[model samples]
Target: MASYKRHLNKDYTVMPNHHLRNKDLSLKAKGLLSMMLGLPDDWDYSINGLVAISREGRTAVENALKELREAGYVVIRKLYPNQTDSGIIEYEYNIYEFPQDEKVACQDIVYQEAHNQGTCFQTIENHQQLNTYKSNTYNKRNIKEIQFDLTGKEETDKCPDKSTPEIELEIDIYTYNVQIHDEFEELWKLYPNKKGKTNAFKSYERECKKKKNPAKFEEVKKGLIAYCEYIKATNTEIRFVKNGSTWFNQRCWEDDYTIQNGKNNQTNKKAQPEYELL
Candidate 1:
């Protein structure tokens, strides 16, 4: 008996430096060409398959392939089988082959053969056909153009006939929403207790709804400032303060807060002298 060992050779594809450095070709075209070269010689040449494998948009892949074909970096050949006894012709597509040099030598031969046989080569014609098919199938509409007056006059004065009820309504809504958020932000900043900001905002919104008046926000603002002062004068620790949401919910601003001296242990009110009844 004889022992046999199988040996495997590493397979790789080579790309010319000129093709990689070609300034005439787009970046997408160069990338696609390099990827095509790396594929096996017998790999499938379907455009849809290439698009899926490359993870690129179909239109982008198609355009890149067109660019490569136009640059003479790739050559496509069409094959036709011999007519059967029934006089029917069968057409087969051939995969494109990448050129080995900057000056592609095989293009003329392929073009001449295809022209003689009255067969089509995958090139600009295919791209045009694909675009035509898409346009017809989707029936996309052209973008409408807006004509503007070149004069320096304001738009309102120029186009007085164009009523803008819908536009005005949209603007009003946007302005109102912005004003509400601005007011809330001012209140949040003035609050002494910073925790539970999201909940605090929700509580503020709820208060706004209950009051149904924009002026209420101003009142809340004043209360926040007073509360911050009270916290400082009393020497209250931040941890001991109520969360913003709880303070807002309880309407703490209405409650009267007196400043007391913690260091001297003195009450906010002045102490009266203790005198015997005279």
Candidate 2:
């Protein structure tokens, strides 16, 4: 286990309003936008480089980039370097940049309609018309059927009493389980090798019980994020990555992994041994 020091950057990228307003953009495109925005200012914006950083397949990255470009959120240009003396011509990689004033007016129009309707806008083009009609019908029906209940006691009797300690304890346990489930989901997304997720979550719960304190879970989460980046920078194949349950059980977050300039130099370490859970 190694001590991980996180480098904090004071700078932040500003997301354009159009990106959020545009409901037509796919989830993958939205994710890709956020990921790209987090990159260093001087990052090389090649498609292959983006694929490596995002851990998304090349085709997915390409399609997302194309979507962003068409949506006016990004601008990509092909560059050609100088010809070599040996009469060899090489094509430079495509450069990606954000357009400052590239606002998607369609998104604004959709947002205005949503605002007027007093509801969130639907992304589907055909469904929007159906939703508007349904909303209007719902409003009219509610206005026509406004009924008043004079017997307040009936309402009180139907509701359960305030939660006792036992009930509160049960609720707390349920909430804790939900939180653990959500945290595990986030960790699983960062893990390159998605194997034995069910087993991994079970192991995570056991580990959480052993630790007792929920705050300690942050250490594992931070370590997993750092490890993900380290493995990606090192160009480690998905096959070489350990299963989530195995990694969690072994507490690999403590292992020292080094990442530098989107490259890692810690391949000399021995392979992680496979662990069979009882």
* Best model number under TM-score: 2
Q: Compared with the true structure, what per-residue lDDT tens digits does model 2 show for residues 1-278?
A: 88889676867665555555568888898888776656654454444466677677655676776677566555322112232221211112221233323332232222111111111112222211111101111112221122211125553343234322112222334445566778888888888878778788877876664523333478888878878878777778887788887887666776677765755555433575675455
Cα-based TM-score, every candidate = 0.33, 0.37
CA lDDT, every model vs. true structure: 0.50, 0.51
Candidate 1: lDDT of 231?
76
lDDT of model number 2: 0.51
Which digits, one per residue and each the tens of the lDDT, describe model 1 over residues 76-147?
Answer: 443333432212121222223433333332433332322111222233332211110010110111111111
lDDT, residue 52, model 2: 75
Task: Report the C-alpha displacement of residue 67, candidate 2, in angstroms.
Answer: 67
lDDT of 1 at 271: 32
Alpha-carbon shift of residue 205 in model 1 (angstroms):
2.3
**Predicted structure 1, TM vs. truth:** 0.33
